[model samples]
Target: MDLHEVCDLIVDCEHKTAPTQAEGYPSIRTPNIGRGYFLLDGVNRVSEETYRSWTRRAEPKPGDLIMAREAPVGNVAMVPAGLRPCLGQRTLLIRPMRSKVFPRYLAYLLIGDQIQNIIHAMTNGVTVPHLNMKDVRSLPLPPLPPLPTQRKIAAILSAYDDLIENNLRRIKILEEMAQNLYREWFVKFRFPGWEKARFVDSPLGKIPEEWEVTTINKVTSYINRGVTPKYDASASSLVVNQKCIRDRKLNLSLARQHKSRVMDDKYVVFGDILINSTGVGTLGRVAQVYEDLNDVTVDTHVSIVRPSNGDGIDFLGLALIDLEPHFESLGAGATGQTELRRDRIGETEIVLPPVKMRKQFSEKVTSLRKLVLNLAARNETLRRTRDLLLPKLISGEVDVSELDIAIPEEAA
Candidate 1:
């Protein structure tokens, strides 16, 4: 069956103009649509009046599938219940014929390898690839099973996604808790026994009298960027790039395979801090390695920062994050692409609290970080399991009708 036949409506957003940030209703764009999920943050907005005007014919509702039509073609995500977002440019809205096809089932099918390959083949453009609505409507779709079987398949797939989502929520909470603690101890100067603590003027403004303002180079033993190796799809080691660092967290999904053999020192380890040292919007972003990320190397655009005393990894990461604006300001460029020199970053000053206090802070956040790591690891496993199962289930290669798996309340 053609995709257009199964869908009640297939429409892209009429408003092709970029929306201003933080000023109006949430505008769903290509960036906001992940593979089978929506990224809640970082989406731009348009005025409510604009949204109402633009969405009169293509109003997005819960259960509708949103797909990227350009930039990165074919990536899809389902609109969650209660979200009344207006679509942004280069995004397509897909409303499934509920009587003929389950929305979640259609969404899963769209993400399967078969449909994605079709999308890739149909996409057009050399510089900025895009899909034509005419081609998108005529794309082939596999024969869907009966409604009950479709529901079963969706239920099975959604279980893994639900657990992953739950873990992500927990990870966010843990991160916020750690950040708040950092703010309390360092930013607000509200550490224990602070009533009697004295203050001293420092280059970074007034800090605790006992604290020392030190350059970044003083506390780091090793600092260097990795080389851009020739890429090999079958390589063992993954190469981390600037995109790997997002929202102060390391997203390994963006990392690609290392092309050639590299030195042991080039490999990332636990306690190492990574900085995106080049590019316009990506420069100065920092992320810390919490575990010995196995067989991973960073690209030239990313600089690795290791502490001198082999301690204070947590403190250094948080401090760098707090001072990100300063580093960003140091970025120099003639063209739009900015670059942060190693020397400038090395000379950047940061408040150094007492060694005991820094150690205490690290120890305090150990459990929270451990939880985050475990949850992240679990999500990775869940993602792998889902990927393996998705194509088979959606293509009817594996029969799930006979299997009696209870649908979780969340899926219900």
Candidate 2:
């Protein structure tokens, strides 16, 4: 069946960018549209007036799906019950016809391998892959099961999504706690025993008595990016690129296999901090390697920063993360493309707290960071399991009809 046949209404977004504010209704841009779910972290906000103006065609409701039509081209995410969001540029709001097809089921179907492949095929021969209104309406869907079966399949998948969402929330909270502590102690100069600590003037600013304002080069064992990889389909080693580092976390699944030889220092270690060293928007983003990554090397676009000593690796990692904005500003080049030079990063100023004080901070934040990493690993596992079931359930190859499942009220 055609997508238009299943959807009651498919509204295109306001062509112009909506004016954003500090806080208001979230504007669901293409970047926020993750597969089968929304990624709302750092989403743009618009005033109530702009939200009304932008959503004049049809306001996105709880069950509607927001799909990207360009840049990425076909990723889709369903709007949850609580979020009141307006469409952003190059996006579409799809409202499924409840009588014809279940909303969540259709969302799952759209992100499924078959539908995604079909969507990609339509974008072929285009300068920038995008869907015109006609093509979007004409996009085909695989044969759907009966409404009851559809609900059951959606419920089965929703269970996994529910778990993943829960973990994601927990991860967010854990990360905030970790970063907050770092800010309080280091940034605000409120670390324990601050009252008795004598103040001193430094190049960066005022600091505790014995603290040193140092450069990244002075304290790191190694500071350089990996060599460009010779990509081969059957390669065993993985290459971590800018895409692999996001939201201050390292996602190994995004890493691609590389056939190139990796030097000893080029390979990322457990405590190494990876920074996106090139490109306008991506440069200066940082993520710490949590687990042991075997035979994994980063690309030229990513620089590896390994600490000189074990005592302050945790402190150094969090400190570097806090300097992301500073690093971003330091990028040199034209507006479109910017590069964070190795020397610039090395010469970047960092305030080093006393050794004992840093060790104490590290002990506290390390526990929180570990919790965050554990939850992230759990989410990865859940995602893999859910992906394995998606195709089978959507295709009706694995019969879910006989298996009793409770359909959520939202889907009903």
List lDDT for all candidates, in order: 0.86, 0.89
Q: Write the per-residue lDDT of candidate 1 for residues 1-412, one digit (tens) a residue.
A: 8999988999977856755657777888887888899886667878878888879878988889888988668989898877778888898889999889989989999989999988887764456778878878888998889988888999999989999999999999999889889989988989887889999888878999999999999999888888777888898779999989978889998899866677888888888888988977788888888887788989899988888775588888888877777877888987567898888989988788998998999889889988998999999999999999999998888998788877544321
Q: Candidate 2: where are CA atoms >4 Å away? A: 125-127
Clashing pairs in 2: none
* TM-score, candidate number 1: 0.94
lDDT tens digits by residue: candidate 2, 379-409: 8889899999999999889999888888768
TM-score of each: 0.94, 0.95
Collision count of model 2: 0
* Candidate 1 Cα errors over 4 Å, as ranges: 124-127, 261-264, 402-412
TM-score of 2: 0.95
Clashes within 3 Å, all models in order: 1, 0
Q: Give lDDT: candidate 2, residue 25.
A: 96
Leading candidate by lDDT: 2
User: lDDT for model 2, on a 0 to 1 scale?
Assistant: 0.89
